[model samples]
Target: MVTSIILMNVERSKINEVAQQLADTEGVSEVFSVSGTYDLVAICRVPTNDDLSELVTRGLLTIDAILKTETMLAFKAFSRHDLETMFTIGLDGI
Candidate 1:
């Protein structure tokens, strides 16, 4: 899976509304309201890395309400959930 963290700059009042809309999109996994240089942080899962780029360029940039965004691609993730799924038969370590 090609995952990207999309930092969105949105109007504070419209953060939730924008997040809700992005959450319904096929590639978007999660959207959270945050306080920072960006207003919302959204997680997107695409079939490929190229698709992730297209999504940010074509889709995200096309939205007028969105001011700007900084996308951070995760090289690897160390999570309990991922570890469990990777070891279906159960591993020696928890």
Candidate 2:
């Protein structure tokens, strides 16, 4: 899986609506309404780079309220959930 994080700035009146829309969009795994230089952050996962392009350029950029975005492509991922799953293998019933 390819993972990308998009830091987004939406129109002040439309941040919530844009975040909700992005959360529902295919390939977008999560959307966070945040405080700082950006109004929202969207986490996307896709099978290939082409899909990632289509999602960011065609899907996300097309949203009317979205003003600008800075995207970061993740090269590696480390999460507590992955560690937990790894350690719990074969221990389902205990």
Top-TM-score structure, candidate number:
2
Give the winner by lDDT.
Answer: 2
- What's the residue-level lDDT of 43 in candidate 1? 88
lDDT of 2: 0.90
Q: Enumerate residue pairs that collide in model 2.
A: none
* Per-candidate total of colliding backbone pairs: 0, 0
- Candidate 2 on 42-85: residue-level lDDT in tens? 98999999999999889986799999999999998775344455
State model 1's lDDT. 0.82
